[model samples]
Target chain A: MKKLINSADTILEESLDGFAAAHADILLLGAERKFVRRRTLKPGKVALISGGGSGHEPLHAGFVGLGMLDAACPGQVFTSPTPDQMIEAAEAVDTGAGVLFIVKNYEGDVMNFTMAAEMAGREVASVVTNDDVAVEKSTYTTGRRGVAGTLIVEKMVGAAAETGLPLAALTALGEEVNRRTRSMGVALLPCTVPAAGRPNFALADNEMEMGVGIHGEPGRRRVPLASADAIAAELLDAILKDLAPGKGSEVLLLVNGFGATPLIELYLMVNAAKRILDSAGVAVVRFLTGSYVTSLDMAGVSITVSVLDSKSTKLWDAPVQTAALRWGV
Target chain B: MKKLINSADTILEESLDGFAAAHADILLLGAERKFVRRRTLKPGKVALISGGGSGHEPLHAGFVGLGMLDAACPGQVFTSPTPDQMIEAAEAVDTGAGVLFIVKNYEGDVMNFTMAAEMAGREVASVVTNDDVAVEKSTYTTGRRGVAGTLIVEKMVGAAAETGLPLAALTALGEEVNRRTRSMGVALLPCTVPAAGRPNFALADNEMEMGVGIHGEPGRRRVPLASADAIAAELLDAILKDLAPGKGSEVLLLVNGFGATPLIELYLMVNAAKRILDSAGVAVVRFLTGSYVTSLDMAGVSITVSVLDSKSTKLWDAPVQTAALRWGV
Candidate 1:
C-alpha cells in the first residue's frame, strides 16, 4: 500500500497537529498525545466527552463544538482510547455542571470510558450506544456493538448539554436516542490500513461480508459479492427486519456510506430501502444520506433507522450548533 | 463487481429518505429530490452551503451543523451535484442574510455551484476553496484545487456566520482562511464506487498516485509509491516549499486520512510534519488528526496547514457550536 508518512510512530501526533492547526477555533491539546478537546470550557454546562479508535473521522473530535461533545480522546488506528487519555479529557472539559461520557458499545471502548468516568473526581454521567441492529444484540461478548448510532446519541445528548440540561437528562436522552435507533452494516471488500500496509481481511475478488464492524472485524456472514441492488436489499432487509417498523411508523432513515461506498450506491440503496419500507407501510419522515461514522475505507454500507416519536423527534428538531453538525428549524 | 440496487435513478430519493429518517432534527424538503437544508435558519447569517460528489462523506452533509455550513447538497456518487440541486440548496438555505456558496474548486463542482448561485433569486456570496498544495497554484485555472482545506474554511467561516458576521466579513474570513492554508495528497490504490464496484484506477502490486483527489481524480503527479516517511517528506516538502511559512510563523496542521489510511499511519506522518516545521521554526499551535474529508475507500492521505496570525488563532479559540465542530473555552 502506498502511504505518506515519515514513520509509522509519528502519524497520529502529526495528524493531530495538522487537524488542530486547521481548526484553532477548536483546541487540540495533545497533553496525553491522543486527547482533543474544545479550547473553551463551559463554566456550568455539563461537559460531554466521547472517544474511541481513531479511524472514524468527524466522529468524536469532529463533533467537539457547541451542542455536542466537549472533548474527545482518540486511540490508535483501530484501538480504543486508553483510560488515562479519557481521564484527562474528562478533567479538561469538565465544569461545575459535571460531565457525560458517550461511548460506543465496543468492549474496549466501554471499559476505557467506564474507567475514565470512575477515575474522574467530578460528577459524571454516561450512556452506551448499542444500537447496531446487525448484532445479535445479546450474543456479543460486549452486548450489542455500537455502530453508527453513536452519531445520533452524540448529537441529541450534546444538544442537551449545550442547553444546560443536567448530566442526568443528557444521559437519559442518550439512552432514549439509542432506544429509537438501530443499524446494520455489510462490507464488499476489506480495507487496508496504511500502517499495516495490507488488507485487514482477504476476500476473493467476488466476495462480500455482512454485519461487518468498523474495525474490519470478521462479519457474521460472508458470501459472493453481489450486484448493487442485491447488496442494498441484503442490508435493508437486515436493518428493517431488525427494526420491524410497523405500518405508517415514522422512521428517520440513514443510508450510511461505509468508508468506501460511493454516494451513488448509497442513493441507490436508499431507493431500495424506500421501496422496502413503502411496501412495509413505513414512512420515512427524516433522512441523513451521507457518512456520519465510517470504517476506514471498507467498501460497504449500513442502514440505520430511528423509529421516531414526539419527544425524540422534537429533540431531533431542537436547535443545535457544532463544527460538523447543525440544525434548528 | 457486486452491489445492491434496483436502479440508479431512484437511489438519491431513497437515500434522502433514509438520511431524513436518521436526522429528523434537520428538516428535509425538495421535490426534485436533489437538495436538503438545516431545519433552523438564521436570517441574514450568510447561509453557508456546499456540495459536490457523494463519496466524500460528511463533506457537505456532516458539515450542516452550526459552526460550519448551514446546508449541504449531495450529488451522485463521484459525480457533481446537479446544478438544480445546488440552486434548490441555495433557495432552501438562504436567509435574508444572503448565502455563501463554498465550492471545492473542482471543475464540475465550481461550475455547478456557481451557476446555481447566479441562478438563484437572492444575491449570494460564493467562495472557492483551492488549497491543495500538490495542485500547483495557477492562473491557468483558478489556483490549487480545494481538498480538505475546504473543511477548514467551512468550520472557520461557519463560526464567523454564527457570530452573525456580515456577508462581506464572512467572505473575507473565508478568503483569509483559504489564503493561509495549503494541502497535498497521495493514494496507494484507486477506490471503487459501489455503483461501479471495482477499482477506479489500476495499480500493480507496488504503485501509487502522489496527489489524487477525493473522487480518484488523477493527481498532479504519479510516482512509484514510496515509504510512509519518504512519501510524507515528499508531500510535505511540496507543501512547505510551496506555502513557504516564514520564520516565526505559526500553523494549524491537519494530517487527513483519505478513505483507507488508518490513524497509526497518520501519526507517523504527523511526526514528519512536525520535524519539517520544527526545523523551519514554524510554531504548531493546534492540530487535528483523522479522516475529515475522505475519498471512497482510497488508500491515501492528505496534509493541510493554515498559517495563522493572532486574530485567526483567537477565532480558533472562540466559543462556537455546530454539529461536527465545536469549542467554548
Candidate 2:
C-alpha cells in the first residue's frame, strides 16, 4: 500500500507518537504508549474509556477529552488492544466516581475489555454497542457489528458522566443510546491495509458494495453503482426499517465518510439523506457531516440515525471538547 | 466519475443546501443561495468576508461564524464567484466597522473580488494570499497560487477583527500573515470535477505528482513514489527554501489533506513533517492536521508553515468557532 507510514510494524507506535505530539495539551501518552488519557483528570466525575482497532481514527483517541472519553486504548490497525493496555488506561483515568468502558460489539474488543475489567478488579461497568443494521452475522462477529453509532453512545454517555451519574445509571444510559441508534454503509472503493499492501476486497469499476462493514467485511451484497439519490434511499430504507421510529420522531443524523470520500460527496449524500428522512416524517433536529469513523482509505459513506427524545436530545446537545467533536464549552 | 452527487450541474446548489441544513444554527443562507453569513451579526465588529471556487469546502463557507468570517461567497465548482455574490455578502456583513475581503490569488477570484470591492460604496479593504511555494505560475494564476495558508490568514485576521481592527489594519495584518507563510502540496490521485465527469489529470500506479495545486494544476514535475520520510523532507525543504526562516524560528505547521486521503496517512505525514522541521532547527509551536483546503476528491496532502512572532502567535491562538476549525472557544 502507498501509505505515508514508515513500516506496518511501527504504524501504531508512530501514529500514537504523532497524536501525543500534536495534542499533548489534551492527551497524555502512558508509559507503554498504547493508551492515552486526558492530560488532566477531573475528580468525582465518572471516567469514560473507549477504544478498538487503530485504523478508525478520531473514533476513540480523537474523542478523548473533557465532556467525552477520558481515556482511550488503541490497538494495532484492525487488531484489538491487549488487556494490559486497557487496564493501564482505566487505572490512569479512574477517580472516586468509577470507570465506564464503551465497547463496540466486536468479538475481540468485547473479550479484551472484559479481561481488562476483570484484571483491574475495580468498580468498572461496560456497555456494548451493536447498532449496525447491515447484517446479523459478519466476517468477524456473530451478531450485528458496531459502526458509526458508537460515536453517539460515547457522546451521550460522556455527557451523562459529566453530570456525576453513578455507574449503573451511566451504563443504562449508554445502552439506551445504543438501542436508539442504527447505521448502514456502502463502499465505492476498498481500503488497503498497510501490512497487507493490497485492497482488502475487490470490486469492478462500476460495482459498489452495500452495507459494507468498516473493516471491509462482507455486507448484504454487491450491487451496480447507482446515483446518490437511489443509494441514499436504499441505505435510509434499511436503517429506518430497523429503527422503526414513530411518525414525526426527532432524530440526529450523521453522514460519516469512510476515509477516502470527499466532503462534497458527503454533503451531497447528506442532502439526499435529508430528503429521504423528510419524506418519512422524521424531524432531523441535529446532524453532523464528516468522517468521524473511517476505514483506512476506503471511499464510501455511512448514514447513522439516533432517534432521540427530550432527555436523549439534551444529552446529545451537551458540551463536548474533544479533538473530533466539539461544541459549547 | 463515481461521486456521491446527483448530477454535476446541481452539485453546487445541493451541497450548499446540505451545509445550510446541517448547520442552520451557525449559518444563514442568503436569498440567492450563493453565499453564507453568520446567523446573527455582531454590530461594530469588523466583518471578515471570503469567496472563491466551490470545491474547497469548509474553507470560505464553513469558516463563517463567531470569531471567524462573517460571510462567505461560493462560486461554481472550480470557478470563481461573480461580483454580484461577493457584493451581496459584503453589503450584508459590512457593519459600521467596515468589511475586509480575504481573496486567494487566482485570476478570476482576484478580479471579481476587486470588482465587488469597487462596487461596495463603503469602506472596504482586501488581502490577496499567494503562499504556494510550488510554482510561480500555474493553471489558473499568474503568480503563486493560494492554498491552505489562506485559512491561517482568515483565522489570524478574524481574530484581529474581533478586536475591532479597522479595515486598513485588518488588511495589513492579513497581508503580513500571508507574507510569512509558505506551502507545497502533492497528489496521488487526481480529482474529478463534477462538470468534467472525469479526473483532471492522470498518474501511473507507482507514480505521484509533487506540488500539485488545489485545482489539479501541474507542479514541479512528477517523480517516482518514494518513502514518506523522503517525500516529507523534500516538501519541507522546498517550503523552507521559500520561507528562509532563521534558526530557532517558531512556526505553525499544517499538514492538510487534498480530500480523499485518510486521516491515518495525514497523521503519519505529520509525524514525518515534525521530524524534518525539528531537525532543521525549527520549533513548531502549534500545528493542525486534516483536510482543510481540498480539491474535490484528490488523494494527497499539502504542508504549510507560517513563521510566527509573538503578535501573530497570540492572534493564531485566539478562539474560533467555525464548523471546520474550532478550539478554545
Candidate 3:
C-alpha cells in the first residue's frame, strides 16, 4: 500500500501514542490505552463520549476537549472497540452529572456500546446516529450509515452539554440534531487499510462510487466520473430530499473531505454546493469546509446538511476547543 | 485526474469564491479577486502580505486573518503571482504602518515580490524564506527552496506584527525565524495539476523521492520505500544537522502532510519525529502537525524544526485564528 507506517499491527497503538503526545495539552490517554479523555474534567457537567472504527480520524478522538467530546474510544482500523474501552472511558470522564454516548449506527459499535452502558455502574444514555441518507442498509450498518453528519451532532450537542445539561437532555438534543442532519459521499479513489496492504476497492479512471460509506462500503451506485457541479447536485439532491427543509430554511453546509481531497477542491465543492442550495431556496446560514471526518486515504468528498434552529445555530457558533475544530476559545 | 473540480480553467476562481463565501466572517475577496484580505483590518498594525503559486491551498490565503497575514495573493497553480497583484494587495491593506512581504525563495516569486515592493509607493520591507535544507540550489530556487517552514515564519512574525512592530522589526524577526528553521520532505506519489491531468512525476511502486520540494522538484534521491521511523530519522538528521541546535534546545516540530496524506499518518510521523528529537536531547516545546503547506494532491510529508527562544516561543503560542490553524482566539 506504500503507507507511512512502521507495521500494520502497530498502526493503532503508534497512532494513538502520537495523538496523545501531540495533544497532551488537551487530551489524556486512559488506562490500557483504551480511550482518550479530556485532561481536565468539568465537574458536574454531562460527559459526552463517542467512538467507532479508527480509520475515520479526527472524528471521535480529535473532538475530545473543552466544548466537544469528553472522551473517545478508538478501535483498530474499521473495527469496533471492546465494551471495556467504553466502560473505562465512562468511568474516567463521567462526573456526577452522568454520561451520554454518541454511537454511530454500525452493528459492532452499537452492540459494544450498548453492552458497555449496561455494565457500567452509572447514569448513562445513548444517541444512535444514522444520518447518512446514502443507503438504507450497508455492509456494516443495519440502517443508513452514520457519516459526516455525526460531526454536526457532536458539535451542537457538545455545546449544549457544556452548559451543564442533564444526561437525558443531552441525549435528546443529540438525537434531535441527528434527525435534522443528512449526509452523502462520493469516492474517487479507494483507501487502503495499513494491514490490508491493498485498496479496499478499485475504480476505473473515469468511474466513481457515489453515496459511499465511511468504511468504503458499497454505496448507492457506481457511475462515470462527472463534473464538480453535477456531483454536488447529486449529493445535495439526495440529502435535501431526505432532510426536506422548507423553502427559506436555514442550514449549515459542510463539505467534508474523505482524507485525500485537498482543501482547494473541497472549497470548490463548497462553491458548487452553495450554488445548488441557493437555487433550491435553502439559505446556508453557516458553512464548514474541511476534512473533519475522513476515511484513511480515500479520495472523495461528503456533503452534510443540517437544518439549523435558533438554538442549534447558537450552539453551532458556540466556542469549541479541540484538536481538529477550534474557535473562540 | 479525478479531482473534484469543475474545470482546470475555473478552478482558481471557483475555489476562491468558495473560500470567500465559507470564511466570510474572517476574510474578504479583493477587487478582481487578486488577493484575500482580512475582513476587519487593524488600522495601525503592520500589514503582513504573502503570495505564491495557488496549489499550496492554505499556506497564503488560509493564513490570512487575526494574528497572521493581512493579505494573500494566489497565483495560477504552480505559477508565480503577478507584481500587479501584490501592488494591489498592498494598496488595499497597507495602513500608515507600512507592509512587509513574506516571499518564498522561488525565482518568479522573489522577482515579482521585489518588483512589487519597489513600485508599491509605500514603506515596505521583505523577508525571503529559504528554509528547505534539501538542496543548496534547485530547479526553481537559487538557494534553498522555501517549504513548510514558511508557516512557522508567518506565525511567529504574525504575532510580532500584531504587537505593533514596525515593518523593519517584523522583517528582522521574520528573517531570524527563517534562519532558525530547516525542513525536508519525502514523496511517495507525485501529485497532478488539474490542468496537466496527469501525475507530475512517476516513482516505482516500491520507491520514494526523499528531500522533495513542495512543487515536485527533484530531491536528494529516490530510494526504496522505507518505514516511517527510518524516513523520519533521515529527514530529522538533515534538519538537525543544518539547524545545529545544541543539546537541551527547545524547538517547534512541525510534521506537514503533502495534501493526500491522512491525519493518522501525519500524527504517526509526529510520534516518530518526537522520538528522534527526544533521543537527540532536543525538547519539542510546541507541535503543529497537519497538511498546512501542501503540493496539490501529493502523498508525502515534510518535517520542519524551528529553534525557539523565550520570545519566539511566546510568539508561537500567541493567538492565531485562520482557517487552517486556529487556537486561543
Q: Global lDDT of each model?
A: 0.73, 0.90, 0.93
Q: Which of 1 and 2 is ahead in lDDT?
A: 2
| All candidates in order of DockQ, best leading | 3, 2, 1
Using DockQ as the measure, the top candidate is 3
Summarize candidate 1's per-residue lDDT along B1-329 as a digit string, tens digits.
54445454555556566455445464454566576677778776788888887767646675676566777888887678877887777777777888888988877788888778778878787889888876654322365778898888887887778888888888888888998898988888777675665788887767788777776777777777687667777777888887888988988888787766655456557766777777778887777665668876677888898888887776665554443444441
lDDT of 3 by residue, B1-329 (tens): 89998889999999999999999989999998999999988999999999999988898999999998999999999999999999999999988899999999999999999999999999989999999999999999999999999999999999999999888889899999999999999999999999999999999999999999999999999999999999999999999999999999999999999999999999999999999999999999888988999999999999999999999999998999887788888
**Tens-digit per-residue lDDT, A167-282, candidate 1:** 78888888888887888888877776657878888888778778888777766778886666666677777777776777789987777766656554565577667677777788
lDDT of 2 at B300: 88
Instruction: Report the Cα lDDT for candidate 3.
Output: 0.93
Report the CAPRI category for model 2: medium
Q: What is the per-residue lDDT of model 3 for residues A1-329, given as tens digits with 9 covering 90 to 100? A: 88889999998888888889889999999987899999999999999999988989889899999889999999999999999999999999988899899999999999999999999999889999999999999999898888888989899989998898888888889999999999999999999998889999999999999999998998999999999999999999999999999999999999999999999999999999999999999999899998889999999999999999899999999999888999989
Ranking by lDDT: 3, 2, 1
Better of 2 and 3 by DockQ: 3
Q: If you assessed candidate 1 against the hidden native complex, which CAPRI class would it receive?
A: acceptable
Computed on C-alphas against the true complex, the DockQ of each candidate is: 0.29, 0.70, 0.85
The candidates score, on chain A by TM-score, as follows 0.92, 0.98, 0.99
Model 1 / residue A88 / CA error / Å = 4.7
Q: Candidate 3 chain B: worst 10 consecutive residues by lDDT?
A: B320-329
**Model 2 CA lDDT for position A317:** 84
